[model samples]
Target: MVIFIMRITWLLVASIFHAGPGGYLQYVVYIVTSLGFVRQSFDVIVDGIEQSIVEAHNNLRPGKIYVNNGDLLDAGVNRSPSAYLNNPAEERSKYQYNVDKQMTLVKFVDNEMGPVGSFNWFATHGTSMSRTNSLISGDNKGAAARFMEDWAEQNGVSKQKGHANSVDFRSLHLSSVLPRRVSTIIPEPNEITDDLMQLASSYVASGGRRLAASNITRRIRSTQENTAKFVSAFCQSNCGDVSPNVLGTFCIDTHLPCDFNHSTCNGKNELCYGRGPGYPDEFESTRIIASRQFLKAADLFNSASEEIQGKIDYRHTYLDFSQLGVSVSTSTGGQQVVKTCPAAMGFAFAAGTTDGPGAFDFKQGDDKGNPFWRLVRNLLKTPGKEQVECHAPKPILLDTGEMKEPYDWAPSILPIQIIRIGQLVILCVPGEFTTMAGRRLRDAVKNVLISGSNGEFNSNIHVVLAGLTNTYSQYVTTFEEYQIQRYEGASTLYGPHTLSAYIQEFKKLATAMVANQEVPTNIQPPDMLHKQIGLLPGVMFDTTPIGTNFGDVSSDVPANSNFRKGSTVNATFYSACPRNDLLTDGTFALVEKLNGKDWVPAYDDDDWSLQFKWSRPSKLSSKSFATLEWTIPEDAASGVYRLRHFGASKPIIGSVKHFTGASSAFAVR
Candidate 1:
């Protein structure tokens, strides 16, 4: 009723303005204004504003943007492009204003201490193409641009600093978005995957991706194909009508109505959607920072000051916790898979199975005990449900349905449920692993974890150890257990293959997650050293800090030093080098210790195990060390075989090989 009155009042206002001319103009304004009353969806205003801007731009720069605005509003207000996005400036502002206003439909939140509300994150089926396809692409500068800039400043900043950086009104989040999954990257059209593709049809037959299908079915209420048809159209073409009264009218493809007030929209009502499941449903994803839900939350909060009045800050601020994985970028040939996080180029790899998949964590077959099958509501109620239960993957041999280990040591990363977090994150790989492939993949993962400000330990982050989860290299701790290779080591918990694989995924997801959680708070901006590098004691770098055992400048030292050809010496060295401006290079000058004078020597049992660019040098006939004037001293004890290692300034001497060093007695007798 109030909406009607507001519309009528608006119509009257238009009449009073156009009283001098014909009343017809007044009627038109009244109509559009009234139309705005019943349905004020974001797209309607965005499109209207966009049309206005484009029309104005066309007048100035013909066909540059190629969008026809068709005089939807009265004259005036030249829509010269924003110039930055290659579009109209005034017009862009107007459209942005309209988008900002309309997208907020119902502005509910308003307090001095920033914002707190939901914002809609636009999820796409595929491609980061353009606004036409509702993609996070093209020169259609919207929230994403702001998200990028805002995210950059949020890492380690104060409110004043963030403002100085324009972090509040920028799209820093969008600029740095990453894929949810490292492995699920779709191959090019020519490179359909045999693992997932062959199984696609089978999955469809058995209700493939059932949850996605169900959601869309509820929206479109049709088969996957028909549903896709509507969604795809909604993305590219305008769906809603200009008239405000009919929400469905605003949406061309979907009959589902959208009201600004959400008065008649029962989001919680099962029948709230216009469509439902029967269609050839397909689930495609593109990382969207400002979704509808998040935007709505923002709208309520954005109804504040004029400066920050436009967009919502909390929109897309948290993990989807629902869709844990992201898109993949597999090459057509499949020979080498390139791990990429288009969001965070600096850090692209560790996906940290963050939030372990999502709500649809249900599995197939039995519904009672299966963690996947047990609906979230019934999860706690049914049978023996606990963290320990998940570890016991129902026996392969019934009566002996027991774990390989009576009390299996569960790693912190993988959690069994979506409720309290799952293996901090789960990874889905596109294919098998190779040594070189693993390297590229791990590098990408490390980059991501380091770049993202999002972290773990504050709360249990359930990451998944899928793909090579059961088989690949074990996800190692920041400890050097992998190098130790002891039966009682931590690596033994996950085994080498599985642990390595999970850690790899965790590294990949970091950037996207951190960007997703671009909420400013207490956090040290990660240094250039990737994967939380820096000089932290337990960080991957410290545990496996670059070890260089082989001598680059080829020359023999003492007979027992690693310089000796074919020697099996464990090239290990730990250093506490002081920091300097110009990159410091810490070198180990391994010299033979002989009677207070250095004897350049080499060892016969060296393998260059801990050195940089380790490689086996040629054989030495003891003549090699002799060439460097190094040998047992003339009056030296027969048992003494010590070597001195000087790391720049600090000097420490060690026995060349265990139990073969100098005698304790130094008497000249």
Candidate 2:
């Protein structure tokens, strides 16, 4: 299951017109987890906000957001969009607002931190988180952005950097993924010819790349088609109805309500339309009967009691993979100390997955191949000897987890966290956990909670596994899976007892929480920050042709023009290098609305309807142009709005100076 979410300016919207406790610099942080994806699911809540902003800007009213009250709309003087979107209603609770809110909060944090301050990640899950593919694609996350941006451009939405670049920035996506093993499928045959074993390692890499390309192609095409349908259908239905209530009326195809808020609406069709099973119902039955047992397991969490009410306590700390050692309970009720070695992937790691075929005939899940085993034994010397013993069934191939120089090939220090509220616990694992591993971890956490609470919370407790959270570690599998030596098992960095170690650690954490005692700091993980390496180069210079000045409004809407819902507004401006290099503190554009005497900030680039696109007319020259577009939403009231673009230009001899371009006022009716 792959989940993709687009979060606009949540913090900015929260802090709108009011200081959040500690001025602008102080912002709240929200952590989310995903095994194969993330927290945000495209929903009516966001659509509603987009509409509210449009209406507020159009009507020249106080332009405030308010939660829905049946059919009553709150006019102006509201707190945050959440205040308006989240109300005491059956509909509000069902929108999965809790999950979506976290995503929004993440976006706000991303905006405040800027490009440099935030987690450096790429949307590899959509393509190949394992780096099997060489092609450059944003994968699912990037594709979502492109789809939305394309829609906005086509519909006439202009990009705006509202609130001093505080809120209305572009969408921020925190990329998370299940361990690479889930996506990298290694087929079964349990045998490889000795001749093929003699092939070069590059051949393996190339084979992996080819397979990755094929998988990515199929995924991208299907995802794009599904996304296009989703967007077009939403737009076609004109579902953004902010009147008579604040919540946008989101529907699937032809007015079928899409969210849980209107769960019983006559036109409700809550099934998510995606690229795989659990969508459309047709393939669901067939896949469910065939190889798709993952769906059944998903039901357990989906149906888990959500009646959560208690204190929310969250703690985060790093764990050094090298020093990881813990006493794990054995199958026979005994215990043994298992220590983690430097990160290393077994030979099966190169075997890939069933979904993505590899080159060699060597199949995964075969622990007894004397010839292959001997070949791996000869592949490396001291390390190979140790790895052979360390990763028993699976011979070590790439000792990435152990590579110290050139900035540790893989992460050594990983983020592990837990969020506990009332009887609910969310174990935030940094890597992917197989079905059995996930189930076991949850059971372990529950057992710990049960024991720690002295039976107070055992029967009523709900523990959810949030995998691939905060950062990517790799994969964690049960010892049974490890012995099988499949791709997932081989990728289990710390070895066969990795899952046991995690269970033990998490239990300890839960025990501390139950006791209401100060959480004990386990041995600290090595701070790999200084040792980290970055491949991206800094911006050299953004030069514009000598003939043009920066931020010049080349073309814009008529000084005074009229528009209505579904109409588009566009502005073209001569721009500089964009200096995306100066991300932490920058703004591309802003949309402003006239409020009697002064113009009020209405939208920023972060707003869903707004889009910012920078392009160089010619690669040979430094000259670049920017286009800002805005699509007037259906709910927009009658009023005037204008767009402003901010940018910078650098000269060969002088320092870069910032400049601005303003568009003509256009009326939305």
Tens-digit lDDT track for model 2 on 5-34? 212211111101000111111001111111
Top candidate, metric TM-score: 2
lDDT values of the candidates?
Answer: 0.21, 0.43
Cα miss at 468, model 2 (Å)? 4.9
Cand. 1 Cα-lDDT? 0.21
Give the Cα error of residue 534 in candidate 2, in Å.
Answer: 4.7
Model 2 per-residue lDDT at 442: 72
Q: How many backbone clashes are present in model 1?
A: 142
